[model samples]
Target: MMKILIIEDEPSVRVGLSFTLESKGHKITTAENGLDGIRIFEREGFDIVISDLRLPGADGIEVLKSIKNISPDTGVIIMTAFADVKNAVEAMREGAYDYISKPFEPDELLIVIDRFIKHKGLELENIRLKEEIRERERFQHIIGTSPAMQRIFETIEVIAKTDSSVIIYGESGTGKELVANALHNLSPRKDKPFIKINCAAIPETLLESELFGHEKGAFTGAVQRRKGKFEAASGGTIFLDEIGDMPLALQAKLLRVLESHTFERLGGNESLTIDVRVIYATRKNLKDEVKANRFREDLFYRLNVLPITLPPLRDRKEDIPLLVNHFLKMFGEKLEKSDLAVTPGTMDMFMEYDYPGNVRELKHSVEMAATLCKGTKIERWCLPAEIRGDGETPDAVISVFDDLPLTERVKTFEREAIRRVLEETHGKKKEAAKKLGISRETLWRKLKEHGFPVSPSDLEE
Candidate 1:
C-alpha cells in the first residue's frame, strides 16, 4: 500500500480524499495547512504528498520545496483552483510530480497516482507526467476495462489521428460526449477550438441559424449578425450531439455542407466555407430512423463514416468496482466521509442489479448512498429505494462472508464474481477473462484457487 498525505484547508475535501485513498488500501494522513504538511513530511516520509495550491501557512510551492529537499524521490501533487493552473504547471518545473484541478473526480486523481506508482516501482529515469496528463486531457473521464471498452479505446486511438467524421452510438448516459472529446483532443486539431451543439435541444425554427449561423433580421431573435458553431469552430472540431433529432430540411443543409464544404447563413445569399472536423452522437438508431423517414438517408450515410458504439454498464459488470470506487471518492469528498466503504452485501447488490441508465445510474446511486449514510461503511439500507426495492439480491450472498477474515471475505467475493461471469460466458474461459479484464493464465489460477475445476466443460454446469 502507498502512503499518501493530503494537505487541504477544506474539511470535506480533505476527508473525502482521505477516505477514497484509504478505501483503495493506501495509508493516508492529512494536514489542515501546508506548513503542517511540510513539518509532517519532515518527520514521516510519504510516497505522495497532495497539497492544495493555497494554504494559510506556507503555500503549496513552499511545501513542495521542503518535501523535495527532504526526499527528492517522493511525488508531490498540487491541488489548484482553475485560476492557479499556471502556477501548478510551473510547479512541475520545480520537481513536483503532478497537479490536479480543484473539484476533480476522485478517479481522475487516482489515474495520476496509479501512473506515478507504476513508474516508481519500475524506477523510470524520467518522472515527467506531462504525457499522461496530455492523454487524459480529453480521455480522462471514461472509466472502463472490459473487452468491449478496450476495443473502443483501440479504435479511438487509430481513428483520432485522422480527420474522419465519427458517428458515436450509445444509450443515454453511456458517455458519447466523452468519446467525441477524445477524438478531437487526440487529433491534429488538439490546439483548436471544439464547439458542441445539441440539435434536439434547440427549436427547429432556430436549429438552422444555430448550425449555419444567421444574419441580422434573419429571424425574431436575430438582434445582430452572428457566427454559427461551424464558423466559430473554424479549423477545429464541431460535435453535433443528438443529430438524430435534426429536421429533414436542416439535415439536407448539413449534407450539402459535408459534400461541398460550404453553407449560407439564414436569409443570406453569401456562402461561407469552413474547415471544421465534424463529429456526431445519438442515442437513436439512424438506420431505423431513416426507414421510418424521420432521419434523412443521405445525411445518415454521410455521418456514419466511422461508427463507435459504447457498451452499457450492465454489459461490463467487472468494471463496477472501479466505477464504484471512483464515485465513492467523489461523493465522499462532498459528503465529508473519508473512511467510506461499501459493505460486501451492498456491493453484491450493486454488481447484480442491472443499471438501465448505465454508468450515470451507478454514479447517482453511489452519491445517494454517500449522502444518506452517517457512518464510514455504506450498508444495504443506505442504497436508493429503487435498488433495494428490486429485492433480487440474495441474503445468502451476504451470509457467506459473515465473520470471515478480511482477505477471506475478499477472496470469496472474487470467486462469486468470477463464477457469475463464467456462467454468463457459458464456460468460455477466454471470454470470461476478457470480461473480467484479466489474463487467461490469471483466470486459470483464480479458478483453481477458488476450488473450481480447470476444465471449461466443468463450468458449463
Candidate 2:
C-alpha cells in the first residue's frame, strides 16, 4: 500500500529485497546506485527510501541528507553492514527516519517500515488538526467583515500596542466579551492570565472583595485569604463586563485603582499594588448614567480614554452571510454534519430580519438549526419561528404608524427601512435592492428621493 524505493548496489541483494517487499504488497521502485535513487526520489514521491551505507557515487548518509533536504516528511531507512553501524548512527543523527542492519531478516525491514508508516500517519494527522484549529480561530473568534467591524478591527490593532484602559460600548449579546478577549490577546500581556468578572452578575456586597484581595477572616465567609481578579490578573488583563452597572460607591474605589494601580482589600487598610490592564464593557450609556447621577463624571473620563462602540447586528447586517457560514461550519463539525449549508430563502430571510439580540443570538440560532436540520442543507422552515415571522410581528415599526397620516407613515417607514438595510449591507446598493425585493433602478431612484447616502457606481443596473 506504500510506495518504497530500494537503493542497493548489489544486484542480488536488491532483487531479493524487492521480491520480499513486493510479496508483502508494497510498491517497490529499485535503483542500482545512490545517484539513481536520488534522481528517482526527486522525480517521483515515495513513502519510504532504503539505501545501503556504502555506495559508489553517493553513500547512504549522503542519500539520507539529500532526501531529507528535499522532503522532510519522507521516511528514510539506512541499510548498513555490522562495521558500518557507526555511519548509520551518524545518518540517523543527520535526520534519517531509522537505520536497518544489513543482512537483516525480511521481517525486521517490514517492522521498521510499518513503524515509519504509523509515525507518518500520526504526523500528518497532527498537522491536519492544527490547521483546523487555526481555521476556526482565524479572527480570534470574532467573525465579521462589515465596514463597522472593519473599523473596530483597525481600532483594536491601534490600541492593543498600549496598556491604556479602554471602554467598549455595545448592546447585550453583541460580543463585548469577545472584543475584550481580542484586545487582550492582541496586547503584549497575551501570555499572562486574563481574568474576567461580570460587574452586574456579582452582588454589590461582594464586588469590592472580588476586585481586590481579602485577608483571612475579613468577612463572614472569609475563612481563608484569597486573591481577587486584579491580583489574579497581575501583569495581564482584567475584563470588567457590565461596568456601567458597578455601584457608584464602588466606582470611586475602582477609579482610585485605575488612577494609582493600587487598592486595599475589604477590611484591610494595607494597599496592594498591581500592574494590571483594565478593559471595561457596558451595555448602558455611561454618559447617560452620569447625567442620571448614577455614574461618576471623573471615573467616566478615566476609563473612556480609548472608546470603542460595537454596532448591533441589525446595523451591520451585510456580515450576516459570512457569520452564518462561519457558524454553520463551526457547529456542523461539532454536530458531525459535514457539508451542511443554508438555503437561499433561509439566507434571504436572515439578511432581512433585524437581529435585536446581535451576533450571539445569530450564533445560537445557527447552532439550533444545525442540530434540527434533517437534510444536508437548512431550509427556511428550519429557522426559528421569529425569523420566519410566524410567532409575532417582525419588528416594532408598525406600532408607531398611528401617530401620522397613512401616506407620510408609509413613506417614512420605507425610507427608514431602506436606510437600515443599506447600513447592514455596508452601502452595497445591489444587495440592498435584492433584500428590499426591488430592481436596482427602483432602489437607486428611491435612494435619490429619500436622500440616502450611496456610491454612484452601486446604482448601475
Candidate 3:
C-alpha cells in the first residue's frame, strides 16, 4: 500500500480525493491548502502528492518544487479547473508527474496514480538492486551486482579451496584474468606464487621453453638455465591465458603435465616434480577446435574441470553504471579531476550502446572522455564518435538548441562539432579539418569565427 498526500483548498474536494484513494488500498493524508500539505508531506514522507493548481499561501507549482526538493523521486500530480489548464501545464514543466482537470471522474485520477505506483515500483527495485550490487562492487577487482555476476561470485567463493583446474570462458576484456587471480588469492596456496602467461602472445618456437623451462644451450638465445612458468608457480597457481591459441604440439605437452606431477625441462632429461594448480582462459570454443584438429581433445577435457563463463557487458547492462562509476573515479584520480561527472546524455548513451569489446572498451571510453573534458563534466560530445555518433544530438543537447534562433543555433552546433573533432584529433588541425570536410584555411577561419583558442602554433599543426 502507498502513502498518498492530497492538497485541495476546497474541503469537499480534499475529503473526496482522500476517501477515493483510501478505498483503493492507500493511506491518505489531506490538507485544505498548499502550505498545510507541504508541512504534512515534510513531517511524513509520501509515495505521491496530489495538489490543486490554485491554492492559498502557495500554488501547486510551489508545492511541486517543495516536494521535489525534499524527495526527488516522489510523484506529484496537479489538479486544475478546465479554465486553469495553462497553470496545470506549467506545473508539469515545474516537475509535476502528471495533471488532471477538475470535473474528472475518480477513475481518471486513479489511472494516473496507478501508473505512478507501477513506475515507482520499478524505480525502487532498481535502487535496491544497485544497493545490493554496491555491497559487492569491489569483489577483488571484479564488479557485478546482477544475478549473473552474483552467481559467478558465489561459485568463485565456493570453489576457492578446491585445487581443480578452472577454465574461464568469455570474450576478450571480460576480466578472465581477474577471475584467475581471485581463484589463486582465495585458494589454500594464496601465499605462494601466482604466475601468469599468455600462450597466444608467445611464439610457438619459444612456447615450449616458456612453459617447461630450458637448460643452458637449449636454444641459441638460451645461454643459461631458466625456470618455466609452471616451475616458478610451483606450490601456487599458474594462469594460462588464450590457451586455445596454443599450438597442437604444445597442447599435447601441456596435457602430459596435467596428467603427471613431473615434467622434463627442455634439453634435459631430469624430471621436476610440480604441485602447482592450473587455470585457463579462452574466447574460442575448444570443442570446435578439437574437431578442427587445432586443439587436443584430451587437453580440452582436462582443463574444462571447473568452468566459469563471464557474461559480456551487453548481457549485463545492469552493471554498466557501476562500471562507469568505477572507471570515472579511476581515471579521474589519475587525471587529478576528483569531481568528475557525466551528463545525463553520456550515461544514457553508455546504457544503450552495445559494448562489443566488453568492459575494456568501456574503461577506455571513460578515460578518453575524462581526458578530453574541458571541465569536470563529461558531455555527450566527449564520447567516442562510434558510441555517441557524430551527428546525433542527445535530448539534453536538443533542449538547449531548442531555445536558440535558427541561424545562431546552426552556428553554435557547428562550433561544437568543430571542437569535438579537434579534441578527438588531439588539436591537430589537419586531421580535424579533414574530418570536418574542410581544408586548413577554412578550419582556421571557422575556428576564429567561433571564438576558439587558436594560436600561431595551431596553424603550424
C-alpha TM-score for every candidate: 0.57, 0.57, 0.61
By TM-score, the better pick of 2 and 3 is 3
Q: Can you write out model 1's per-residue Cα lDDT over 1-461, one digit (the tens) per residue?
A: 89999999999999999999999999999999988998889889999999998888999898999999999999999989988878987889889999988879999999999999998976753434554434333265677767888788889989999988999999998889989998998899989999999999999988888888889999887989988899999999999999899999888888888999999888788988879999999999999999999998888888898999998888999989878887898888876679899999889888988888888889988986786554698887557545665553545554645888988767766865776676578668989989999988888889888655577553442
Q: State the lDDT of candidate 3 residue by residue for 1-461, as single tens digits.
A: 88999988888888888888899999998888888889999999998998888899888899999999999989999988999877887888888999998989999999999999899889889999897756665358788788999899999887878988899999988989889989999899999999999999998999999988999998898999999988999999999999999998888888887788789899989999989988899999888999999988888888888899999999999999888888999888987889999888789999988988999999988987786665788887667767786467545554565877898678757876887787689778989998999988889999888655577776777
Count clashes in each candidate, considering only residues at least 3 apart in sequence or on different chains.
1, 2, 0
Q: Which scores better on TM-score, 1 or 3?
A: 3
The true-structure Cα RMSD of candidate 1 reads 20.8
What TM-score would candidate 1 get against the native? 0.57
lDDT measured at residue 392 in model 2 versus the true structure, 0 to 100:
37
Question: Could you list the CA RMSD of all candidates, in the order they appear?
Answer: 20.8, 15.9, 14.5
In model 2, the worst 10-residue window by lDDT is: 391-400
Index of the highest-TM-score prediction: 3
Query: What residue runs in model 1 are displaced by over 4 Å at the alpha carbon?
Result: 1-138, 392-461
- In TM-score terms, candidate 2 sits at 0.57
